[model samples]
Target: MSTTTAVDPTKTSSLRSGRRFGDAIFSALSHSAGIVILLVLIGVTFFLFWGAKDALVADGSEVRGGAGLIAYIGPLIFGTLLSSIIALLIAVPLSIGIALFISHYAPRRLASGLGYVVDLLAAVPSIIFGLWGMQIAGSAVPSFEFLNEYLGFIPLFSGTVTTTGRTMLMIGIVLAIMILPIMTAVNREVFLQTPRLHEEASLALGATRWEMIRQTVIPFGKSGVVSGAMLGLGRALGETMAVAIILSASGGGYSWELLSANTPGTIAGDIALNFPESFGVERSTLFVSGLALFVVTFLVNMFARWIISRRSEFSGAN
Candidate 1:
């Protein structure tokens, strides 16, 4: 038995309008930020291509091995892909293993500590990794000599091992280590995010812990693993300082021999080594090489995305 308080329709309308206005403002800001990022990427790509045009049109210069745009970039492409592939091959499995141990097998406190250590590795500068690769890791691995000795029959391994062991294989190994922390960090987070309910259900069905992970965790995290691997590959592809420091590319071109003293040609390394001395057409050619690398990386990323999207359909991740 109390008097009814009448709600003002105008007040409710104003409140609803205010919320809608706020949401609209937030959404617009987010969309604008994304657009700005996209525009910046496009602008950079355009600049690279524009800078490379002079080199592309010029006749083959004897200085650049009488190689036109295609020839100029071809070996660098091969080197970049080869080194990155090797790094991924070595890093991915180890990263996944480390991630699994941290996510599932380790004590919570220990896992947290280990994760911090792994993250700390990523904070180390690329220059430091390059220095270590040049000074320490290069000499520490005698496996290069061993491989050259025993596996020399294989074309891939057939090469003279340098005193410094600064071979493509060594670069790949160092790149693998450089990328390990990043791959591990991403994979661990993804694995940790695997649905607890699914894991519990698998275990409740009398599955062993390993079996539970195999059935529940791996399936859930497969896409995430691929994503992390691709991220590492991107890093390896663009790595400059380490490759430049560790690689002894002296022949003015790329080499495929993993154990060769000839350092694998990479765009970033090439730019670092030659840009200072480059002039006019030579400088333009360097820009051309950068454009090529940009295209290659872009394509690789697109391919990875396509693969992930296709797999997602079957994996029920969609």
Candidate 2:
């Protein structure tokens, strides 16, 4: 037989009251943090607009680029997007392949070691990458002549071959290496999180290892891969030091010929390279470029979020 002791009303009430109080405090703190972030973002947007107003309304001759605001910023925007896209194109496949090998194909001991090495790469400074690109990758400029001979029909490679080795392509390759670890780490974790049950079921159905991965693992982690790619792109877009150090771009010279020495300036690199010497409307113009970068990064992140939240098989939240 068991005896039940009657609870004291005061004690029970006190316990419930304490829990509610704790919950309220936690909720308030979380809400305040989120609100603070939103407020900071709003403040930054307002500040950029305010600073850029003079340049935006000013005459072309008064501006640094000797062109209107749109014309000045056009090449910066193009270069920024082109560099980031190139990084994305190079990093994504390599990241996915390394992740697949680490998560599925490699021995457990080898996988762990390789993952550590990859993750360690993220800690390497951008300055180090820039130096390497300037000294080593820049030396390979002449080598691109081979590709141009065969691939010159492609518009991207059609321009006058660069002898300086400081073209847009060099910086793009540097950015790709810099962002590689981030995407690889994200992809490896996502691939590892694939449901064991699904993998087993695929295998039980007489699927090969590759088939099991294709049918189960890849589909399950597609959302994560997209998110990771976006994150890497954001870094690539904002990268300044490396681009500033590697690109030999002159003024507002926008060119679609990526392999040429006449590389278009990127917004971040332009701002970094010019901000110290900039004055009056020129400084304001730099602010406008910053604002553009802010918008682009924000939109990319939001789009990635929307994609991840969509009712797709990979999202797992349907």
Candidate 3:
């Protein structure tokens, strides 16, 4: 024989109603947040375009550089890309290696300490980095006279060396150091998240530690490395203070000479230096430069997203 208990209709209805109420509230909150973010992005885009309208349509003579939009903004964009590229080239590989060591190879105690140190490094202010780059680090650039003298045959090293030691090369190095912590932190986290089973299985198949890392770990964390590198690149691109402080204006146009004081001007640096004194067309021109930066940044992010998406197409769903 089976016994059955009658359910209370009042309790059942109340429970369903409460759940529906909570879900509605949650949906409303999430939708509101997304709308707010979208609105802010739209606002920024509107500001950039509206502020730049005057300069975008202005005559070459009225513009700051007296050479028109492309001619003037070209050098700044080129410089920005060049310096950021230099920093990425130096930082990405080093960051990955350090992260791998911290996550996979180091003693737990030492790794814990190192992780804290990296986080602290990230928390340090950008302006402090600028001051340090300008004063302490820039001084070391002159010591690389051998690079200039011996490798002078290369156009990159062929330039009039300055006594102050402020050059594009130093800016790149400073940017590298500034962005290192960010990339390393992301990489370490990603590496740590690699499946224990996958790693162990590779090792159990007669693979050495390095071989397991090469096959299982690197493949799993490759996307993370790209994402982290993109983040570092973004920071490098928008770097205003460090580049402004270290950048000495000898020739504020595009240059292939990394060792020279005659380095190219970045858009952000140029705007910071000139915006206060600017007026009329010059002011609008600066806005146009800002718009250019926004465009470039957006394009870069899109390209990176495309790359990651393409890579994902070849990866297993799991």
Candidate 4:
């Protein structure tokens, strides 16, 4: 009976109050972080909008809408999309393959080393890639002229080659290299997250390694792969230095024909190249181009989020 006395109700109440207080503090911190993020987003939108106001207005130009803005934005948007699309095409498959190798096939030691190499690649700076593209890739273009020549018939690659290497193809290749790390890392993580139970069950069902991965691993990780690729696409769309150094015709519209050497100018590249020298209306035009980029990137990210959300809902329902 002496040992049966419960702990003091007052002490228990105090402990509960303390936990509640700690939880409130943590909740406040999380809310503050979210508020800060919202503020930053708003600030960027306001700054860019304010900066580009003049360009959004109709000038005396034939185009009724913001001609200057359109003119400035025309090439940049195409270039950004073009380069990103190219990078995605190359990076996504390779990343999936590498991810599969690491997750299902490779020994632990080998997988770790390969993963480390991929992580190291992600750490490599854009400037370094740009420099390498300029120095080495540029020089090697001639050796690979067959690719250019074969594809040159396409309006996009019609540009004549010079001693200096800057071509759409070259820029695309450079972008592919730049985005590889992002896609690979994402793929690896998503694949690695495949539950041991699911994998073992798949194998026990007489499934081949590839069959297990295709049915179980990929299904589980598809959304993550898409997320990763979207992130890489964002990076590619905004890439400046490497594109600036690698693209030959970073100022004009798309080459309608394939294999055109003319480098389509991306919005980010144009801003980087011309913003410093621009003034008055010209500067405002650059801002307008930036606004366009902001819109497109925003839309792309929103679309990706929507897709992911829908997929998540579907998965949850199942």
Candidate 5:
């Protein structure tokens, strides 16, 4: 048989080199976009910190005298953390359960429809939730009167609503509702990403659907779930309108009443309430509060990343 002439290998190399050049150009552009985003963030932080430097200096003197920054942020920090933690406690499990149900328990058609509904809820304006919480949640305050009276033994639930009837519990519930959709959506996505093989293997071994989910799905998605909840918590911590609408400004500091929900206002709510026409020290203080919140949120996210990194080692171990 006559041998045909072989194609020149140099031509193939030249084509690959051209593609590599194009790829390098595209990658450089994409990487530059990320760097620009990072720089923007740094610039914003620097501006805010610079703007608040004077106030921080004022507060710093008190802190140096052994009073600590507590004098400036004690109430705001407490309110922000407390409300966020309560919202987290209520939202995380509910979101996870809803996510699981939608991901695994529901019929495919129903799951798609329900997921759309939940996503719609997420898109609803935070202002609407605030108004609804203020008007509707405030109206429901009387219903919890029994708990207020009996559970008054506990600080949280101890306080009664105003004659107009609104409490901190009302605010926390509003926050919970606002953040639930976020956590649920995140958890659902994570669960959906669970490797099918792991789940199939568990089911093939005569395990119940729930058992398979518990053993194969939830563990795999645990880090993602935590990250989602933490993200939701971050949103709740900085929620301004809803908290402002639901939480009145009267409460100054931590209250012992478990159901009081009325003790202190969150930093975001405080900023919103006070921002307009606020000048000098007050405005500076507000900026500082915002900075503190930013720091806390950043720390939570960092911790979540650390946890997520650890999960890779544990995910397939079982």
Candidate 6:
């Protein structure tokens, strides 16, 4: 004979209800955290706009005819975009090559070690990179002389090379180095995620390793590569210490001479250099510049997202 044991329905129901309550609490907490983050972003944007409204509305004075919003930030915006673009052009290809090497060419141990080394670069302080750019890279690269020698006919490079070598070209090169590690790390992970079956199938079809990478790995990781490039550009655009330290702030206005000592000034650099002495409208102008930068970065990221989405749709179609 066997004795049957009965479960308590009330207790079981209570346990289920308690779990549901706990889940609800956690769900609400997570949602609250997300809302808080959005609120903080909104608050900061409001603060910037509020501070900049005066500067935005200011009319040009007799002394400084082009002293209004567009004049104040036109060069800064140009410099920021120019430098960031230069940095991305230099960094992206190198980053892809380095990432591909680490992900596919290097031995397992070597790959891991190289990856660690690359990542370690990101951990270094921006101040250190600035210092390195000022002291070592500026002198070592000889970009000024090279640009003047080869590309002097071009308007951007047609300038007298400064002995100090604190030109936009130099700043761009330093920014490239600063951004390289991050781009490489991101691309490395993306490349590594390419399906092994796809790679093997490509090889089975008599495709060489390089060919396989071109057809399979690169296609699979195209969006990731673009993302990595965008991330690097974002960092380069907002870089303050590096640009401030590497560039000469003596010139008060913008010039198109990228190789000249008195090159176009960046918003981040200008803000850092002048914020200490700025007051009243001048301070508000800096906020306006910052707001411009925020908008530019936002638009760039949005453009990148749109590109990624289009690529995804195309991939899905195939």
Q: What do the candidate models score in CA lDDT, each in turn?
A: 0.85, 0.88, 0.86, 0.77, 0.80, 0.86
User: What TM-score, to 2 decimals, does candidate 1 have?
Assistant: 0.90
- Candidate 2 residue pairs that clash: none
For model 4, how does the per-residue alpha-carbon lDDT over 2-104 read when each residue is reduced to its tens digit? Answer: 8977777655554464447788999999999999999999999999988877666647362212345556467668778877887788888988998889877
Q: By TM-score, is 1 or 6 better? A: 1
lDDT of 5 by residue, 1-318 (tens): 346566667565443544477889999999999999999989979988986776788755533223445655777788888888888888988999999999999999999998999999999888999988878865676666777777767666665545545556676778888999988999999999999999999999999999999998899889889888887888898899898877775655666443554467788998898889677766777788888888888887898888778757776646
Per-model TM-score, in order, reads 0.90, 0.91, 0.91, 0.86, 0.86, 0.88
- After superposing all C-alphas onto the true structure, candidate 4 shows an RMSD in angstroms of 5.1
Q: After superposition, how far is residue 8 of candidate 5 from its true place, in Å?
A: 21
lDDT of 1 by residue, 1-318 (tens): 245566667665543644477889999999999999999999999999888888878888633546567777777888889889989999999999999999999999999999999999988888788888888756655887788789889987886777777777878888999999999999999999998999999999999999999999989998899999989999999999999888877653556678766755788898898999988888889998899889899999999988888866667454
Q: Candidate 1 — which residues are off by over 4 angstroms?
A: 1-19, 252-254
Clash pairs (backbone) in predicted model 3: none
TM-score of model 5 vs. true structure: 0.86
Residue 61 in model 1: lDDT: 68
What range of 10 consecutive residues in model 6 has the weakest lDDT sum? 59-68
Local error of candidate 4 at 218, Å?
A: 0.8
Cα deviation at 27, candidate 5, in Å, is 1.3
lDDT of candidate 3 over 1-318, digit per residue (tens): 235466667665543644477889999999999999999999999998898989989999888789898888889999888889999999999999999999989999999999999989988877888899888754576565767888989987887776677888888888999999999999999889888998999999999988999888888888888899999999999999888888875545778888776878788888888899999888999999998988998899899888878878644345
Residue 112 lDDT (model 2): 100
Candidate 2's C-alpha lDDT?
0.88
Candidate 3 residue runs with Cα over 4 Å from true position: 1-19
Residue 9 lDDT in model 5? 71
